[model samples]
Target: MEHVVLTVQSQNQLQQALQQLDSSWLNLPSGRVLAQVYSRNLESGWLLSVSAELRAKLPNITVVGCSAMGIVSAGSDWNNATVVSLLRFDKSSFVATLLQSSPDDEYLDGRNMAAELAIKQRDLQGVLLLSNPTKLATTRLLRGMSDELVNLPIFGGLAGDFSQKLSTSVMLDQALSDAGSVIVAFYGEALRIKTFNYLGWTPFGEGMTVTSTQGDVVKTIDNIAAYDLYNYFIGIEKTGFFSSAMEFPLMANHGGKLVARVPIAVGEAHELVFLAQLEPGDTVQFGYGDVNSILSDLSFARHDLISFGPEAILVFSCCCRQSFLQDDPRAEIQPFEDVAAVAGFFTYGEIDTANVPRDVLNATIVSVGFSEEPAPAAEEDDWLITERAEMKMSRNLNRLQRLMCFISRMTEKLNAKNQELTRLAQLDSLTGVLNRRAFEEQLAQEFQHCRMISAPLSLLKIDLDGFKQLNEDFGHAIGDQLLCNLVDIVNRCVRHTDGFARYESDCFMLLLPQLHYGEALVIAERIRAGVAQSLTIKGIPELPKVTCSIGVAKFHDEQDTLDALLSRVDFAISRAKSAGRNCVKGE
Candidate 1:
């Protein structure tokens, strides 16, 4: 495989670049040739003229082009210019197609396009796609394509426009489209394709739940207007929110992976509009670009590209990343030139076909490497030096990264400590059981649940028959130990679903959901027997045998309140104590 990357500023430059290609290789019937044009200029007439000139010069060349926010080439990135990449393959072939589509019918359009491409080549290896992000649903379109092209690699990006008009265009052969897609289907035994993406944005602050949404517009997050979230946290106002929010996008878990969503506009109701759909109940965190992390990831990606040894690399990087990286926008793209020729554009959103079902990503850089040769075995020193010495970090970036890490770790520790405190507050310190207040809260929840489902619920009020006398005789320390031992024995006799609590000094309560009076009575009898046999005061040869009086009461009709149920259980316990010291009774 042979390829050339050139930056063209005018029609004459494009013609000159095309003239540099070998005419013999262009005319070879068994060879495949592809020309990808990424232009920052959105003039329709100028683009059309350039397209016409290319087709006139090379009639057999497959041309796939799109409008770009910025064009990228080997070791450099350009704005308000065009980059052309010419690829000639000796053992591989490809078919290119253009399909007009409507936003309302994007899925059908995608399926139709994929179906046509699948029939074009029998040994389809991969696909290259370019579409208008503003005029179509790219995510749904990718899903439709995935339905037809299962496990097939598709890599490209949405056409980008930096002008206020926001009109993006794509070109195929001699035709240009503003509301359609262009696809190139590559097929051959010798062609090999690999894709990789790097997102170095670090998520900060607490995750907020998406409370309400309408299509791609998020109305509220954490029950407040979405705009308020950005305003309060990131200090971004509705005015120029799109540009200001570029540095900080929302990172959410989509399809089991953390995908970034960049806000394109703020609505009149203060809702944030994104390029992709977001559902309510999804958790999102504000993410900011970290220079250190980005460079670190670039080091690993550079190593992988070197090992793969591709002939050419195509980049589809997010425009937001360009804005975040500022002066050094090509830092991520320059490293690829060491292994292969590189050319692509900064996109509005990137299409990553590396994952099954594919994903439309924002604030990410997607690299697609093409090779006709197998990778060679690695040398011992090949992995030793991955990062370049020239990639130095600024003092401000280092301090910012250190501060971010410190804040993140502190927030996590504080959240963990808060959760532990909450759990401790609900438990009894001595017995490790639910305290009276916590038990009542749980019992109220269970009561309401039983009422809703019309299920049976039983409560057992247990009292140690001689707790007061034992406390005075054995001292309070031994009495406390005895209570702890008795709780362990009773816990063994009950199901995990049952709620056990220390209701008072010598009284305890057990809540049994979905259980009737008979089941509660059986459990109460088992607890009485277990405590009698297992509990014994230490350092005393023979003290009064530990025993408990249990009163089990089943919930009555709809009119029965929690207090009324407790009253009945207390009466039952009074009867048990009057009859005998150690016994079980039910009401």
Candidate 2:
């Protein structure tokens, strides 16, 4: 009997709760068929305390899992509790593959991965897989898995923080190593897999066909490198060479799979980065995720509840997606509740049958809702009410909601405008850093105050590593996101009281107070770390990662005026850059 597939989760008291489950569930008939118990992580490794007991009993039955947002136990405010789900399968009815390993393998390798399922020789009912989807081209992984396995009906999702998918998957008990995965594949009879294809994103602009290209990394489209084509559409200069285009594309479920055609990104330089995911020869359409549209899609589904609902569902949503209109998921829960009684955490990526029947893609959310009993017929009460009386009663509430949303939008716009104005006044607009005037004012203010107080103050100067080469390689947009991300990182590491002003194009200065000379070295190291990290901006690829070097100097009342401090830091900074792209040194 396929009973309820309940995934109980909590982020509190993880150890105690697991003990209670071990004693109670280990012997229960519900778990005897195969109870795979797993604990959650606190963004780190799960404790051996939680694992030692479970591993003792089910030595052969492997459970590949990880934490749910935080360390947890059941009923621990959801965010503080641990999560454990029981899959009671009729061992006779289904051939399940529990692939577990260390950093190297979860339970099985690719060869065993294909063989384990093939042995089931069970009619390929469906593939319910879950793994870490970070950085890995899951689409490519499964394409290979299915090509060998042949026509496996795929369902399920990337099992990680769907809400925050930036981190890679953390399979339970697996070594916390990068580029590792824990794969779970299930095959059996008595299971009917029905797939519902939905990209949910709608296309916006005109369609552009690929005039030329290669594999996933497109070389050219319409006789131009994909990047050049995008530059033309968005008005980016081609002074530097580029690989791809600013791909603004909508997602579609054509031929029973999800594909992002013509992916696009808005770079920090106000230019576009092409995030092309489709083949170069394929035609592309521009699209984006509209929060309102997604909400509307949910409402529309309610009307056609006859389509894919009425049964309980497990929703696997893309982790990259931060719900827009219903950003406050709690407020919007009622809407989804009305649909499938959905109780699915966000997914790292979703696996859906792709272009071919049963081929899976890398980044997607898969929803699997099972009905314990036959669904009841729709009734009059179930029909949504457009009640005039209730409508009148809720008028004030509706008005207030609209007003609040309007105010929020206005606040965002105002902030954007203020940032622009500040940048224009204080920065070299072309370089997008503090201008010469702001720099002078800041330095003067810091110098005078620190001089009077006899406090320790430090100065820093920075220059991009190989900036000219940046201009020679990919164009200016790449240079722009790099700078923006760099500044953002520096801001994150610096104190609010500290000041950062760009003195020239590709040159920035940081002023730190209330610190001694050696302390300045520590701050300099942090600045170096912040600027040297790479972040992928949406809609662009082939953006060379960013690197920078910092030179630090301390203010001495005797030898240091504002100009002297700047010159020393500037010189030290120049030396740092010359040594290597990412370093911090002090004088």
Candidate 3:
């Protein structure tokens, strides 16, 4: 290999203007191959077909690529076509993994796939990855691969579309072709990998220490939910809890022009949902106040890259960032040619392995240039990666693990919160009982559990007799309040284990465990009596009276499931409805 050789720019046309450029020179045949392609968000079959054509040219390709945000067109908009940048060298040296749309078989093994690729590439140095930033978890993917490759380098960026809507990643291979990850191992000295990328942003204003954070949600800053810190920082005294506070650009020092020197968008939330990317214990303050200064710093990073000595390079950057420097992104890299450089298209998310002590978490980039010369493997050092991450965090990453714990625990609480919701789904929204679906499913489960325990299960079908008359006479709001108040009354009378669902608009089904026939009737009558008395909502002072008619039935060994029990109780409830309003009847 020449001290700096092989500059390949393969640009093929899909429809009109050619759209693609894959340039790689240094690791000619390594253990891994990174194949990425980006297309317009709404582009059609012809576009997908065109990409497949070029991908077919490569051997042993494991496909994983996503859409791109406005492709850099030397100052022109290139929205109609997709760009595919292929970087490959050496076979059997890299490992690629695909997470696709299918449940794995119990016998499925990933190690086997990796081993096969390793058998071909032999001396694997690192891993190259490509994934859709959309459906797939880019964050999770990188974290997972960091473990698998452990101390090995990983690099690539998210597929993007300027629209930021739904997009696809092409996973091209002769055997399996679809939208998923495909990992292949390379054998030997085909590629050289190292990185010179940084967050390239900074912190500004007075810093606020992250007090309490859970995942991306900051419960408090300065001991208040992080929103207050955001509001205080952004100078938003009114509606301090609003989402805008979080969305505002937050600045931190990754320690100079190397990481960030100003404005980087942080987190925020609105409505009842929280939306933020920052964890607690981080020191953040307002940023973007000086947009021009920030742009100057960004431009300087690219201008500085030519000094690194790359014969040719490709850039992957953040789409959220495009709008900020849309004025002239190419101007920053124009200096690349001044230093042994030929370059090509840029991307939404970029990835490169960083040698952080004992680990390598692939760093995403705003702009990174690859040099094919004997660059002496600056990537071999471990400290550079850690320094960059800590700098990116503004040296406030010490509490990230604790913050992740907070997020994990909170997630558990939210997942288990839907018991009441499940109950209401089966019942009428206003009624305080089983909804039809829940009643049925629970009836089956309770029946089975009781069958195992050899206990009795009672089913009561109840309806508000002449309830529609009240709705007609008293307006629906009063009727609704009547139903709500009625539930509170009924809940107290039922056993803790007993459940209920709304059977329909004016009807409900209650399951009473360990209750005999008489007990069921007594419970039913209690509901009837409670409803006869009118109740007031906490805010509303007036409401007309309402009552219910109840019907009851029981389960026996002879009966198989809940269906018959419901049928019998519904029949009895119908009889009560016919005979009189506000009464209990059973069969």
Highest lDDT model number: 1
- TM-score of candidate 1 versus the correct structure, residues matched by position: 0.80
Model 3, TM vs. native? 0.46
Residue 446, candidate 1: alpha-carbon lDDT? 94
Tens-digit lDDT track of model 3 for 530-571: 767744455545444456788888877744566777688888
Q: Report backbone clashes per prediction.
A: 0, 53, 76
After aligning candidate 1 to the native by TM-score, how far in Å is the CA of 416 from where it should be?
A: 4.0
The true-structure Cα RMSD of candidate 3 reads 17.8
Using lDDT as the measure, what is the rank order of every candidate, best first? 1, 2, 3
> Relative to the unseen true structure, what is the C-alpha lDDT of residue 355 in candidate 3, on a scale of 0 to 100?
30
Candidate 1: worst-modelled 10 consecutive residues by lDDT:
386-395
Task: Point out where model 3 deviates above 4 Å.
Answer: 1-12, 15-35, 55-64, 72-75, 86-97, 101-122, 166-170, 173-187, 211-248, 251-277, 289-311, 338-350, 355-587
Query: Alpha-carbon error at 29 in model 1, in Å?
Result: 4.9
TM-scores, in order shown? 0.80, 0.47, 0.46
Which of the predicted structures, 1 or 3, would earn the higher TM-score when compared with the native?
Answer: 1
- How far residue 77's Cα lies from its native spot in candidate 2, in Å, is 6.0
